[model samples]
Target: MTKSEKTQIIESLTIEFKESNAIAVCDYKGLSVKDLESFRVAVRPLGIKVQVVKNTLASIALKNAGADGLEFRDTNIFIWGEDQISLAKAISKFAENSAGKFVIKMGFFEGNVVDTKHIELVSKMPSRDELLGMLLSVWTGPARYFVTALDNLRKQKEEN
Candidate 1:
């Protein structure tokens, strides 16, 4: 690519790093183009963007975005999104089926460098929507009990 093109790519990647909640890096060395395209399709619906980036450019973007301590190496496919959990879950699922082709290098989430183990743990955790639903249930529990108590009182008054 030309110098201008490289500059543009860096600029855009820098923006992406700034906007994304988390970024997952993987070594997609043995994967085919078809596999990569299929992976992209799977993640696109989840608001995730996957791309193969040159290590140097990615390093520059990461540094520019203030992400400390991620080493970029050969054949890196970057997966990033607003929902960190979804990114982790999606990549984890994809990697799970890859036998040994897709390897997890590391990740950056909420300003921390998360290792592969942590990424796997995060992947298994419920999504943000699921967590929110759980919280909503908890929040409504007291209200439900209050209404039931009021109904019981009304029944007693009627009996009297």
Candidate 2:
């Protein structure tokens, strides 16, 4: 690629990385184009982006975005998003479903380099929406139980 094109790519990636809070690097050595595209479609709704970028350019962009410490090698695909938990969850799920073809390397979470284990841990945690749903359930539990009890009391009185 020419100097200007490379510069443009780096600048765009830097902006993307700056907006994203989590970035997961994966080795997509044997994945087919269709598979990768499907994966991209699946995560697109979650505001995640998937791209295969040159390691040098990606490194420069990442560094420029203030995230460093990941060593990129071989064929890599980057998955980044604003929601750290969503990013971790999506990549982890894709890695699992892709069998051995797609492998999760390391990641940048909140501008700090994190290991695969840390990423996995983050994936297992509930997402923001899931947490909100759980909180709503907890908040309504008492009222639901009270209604159920009142209904049962009315039914017993009618039987008597």
Candidate 3:
């Protein structure tokens, strides 16, 4: 590739890194084009992007965005999204389902480096929307209980 093309790629990736909340790298060494494309489609709806990029360019982009420590090696497919959990879940699920073909390298979660164990933990975490729903439930739980208790008391008084 020419220098200008490489520069453009690096600039674009740097912008992506700055915009994303998390980034995960995986080795898509043996994956077929169709499989990769299908994976991309599955993740796109979740706002995750899957890109097959050259290691050196990725490294430069990552460094420019102030995220370092990722090892860009053979057949690396970079994955990222606006939130950490979604990207982590997608990558962890894909890697697990791939039966070791798509080996996960590591990740940058909330500006920190994450290993395999952390990635697994992140995959199990509920998405932001789910967490918000849970919080809403928690917030309304006591009020609901109070209203039910009042209704039952009113019924008992009417019976008496």
Candidate 4:
């Protein structure tokens, strides 16, 4: 586009990347527009943003945002969000279903540059909500068993 437009985009993206918890650079070479749209829809609810940006602009933006060490090349689609776990999970799941058409090249997570394997590991980790739910279950387990045991004891005493 025009120089002004490019400048505006760079400014906005710099701000966005600065606020992001993680950014995944994916190679979406063989995927269709429809596939990309559906992927966008799927991750929108998770607060992830999907975009196909010029590599140079993206690199500048990332560098301006204080993230470095990533080199973008060849048809990259950027997937980013404020939640690293969700971003990793969503992109990894999409990559799994893409059948080699889409690939996870590398990522910037929490100030560190990571690879596909590292992204996969982050994806497999429990989300904040899932971790909270597991914690709640564990915390209430003993109380629940105690109540059940007390009820059973009362029933047996009444029978006697």
Residue lDDT tens for model 1, 15-86: 999999899999998999999999999999999999998888889988999887999867899988899899
How well is each residue in 1-160 modelled by candidate 4, as lDDT tens digits?
9999999999999999999999999999989999999999999999999999999999999999999999976899988899999999999899899999999999999999999999999999999999999999999999999999999999999999
Candidate models: Cα lDDT each: 0.93, 0.95, 0.91, 0.95
What's the TM-score of each model vs. the native? Answer: 0.85, 0.95, 0.91, 0.97
Give the Å shift of residue 36 in candidate 3.
1.2
lDDT by residue for model 3 (9-127), tens = 99999999999998998898888899899899999999898898898999999999999888766788889889888888888888888878898889998899999789989889999
Looking at model 1, residue 143 earns an lDDT score of 100
Better of 1 and 4 by lDDT: 4
User: lDDT (0-100) at residue 73 of candidate 3?
Assistant: 62
Clashing pairs in 3: none
- By TM-score, the better pick of 1 and 4 is 4
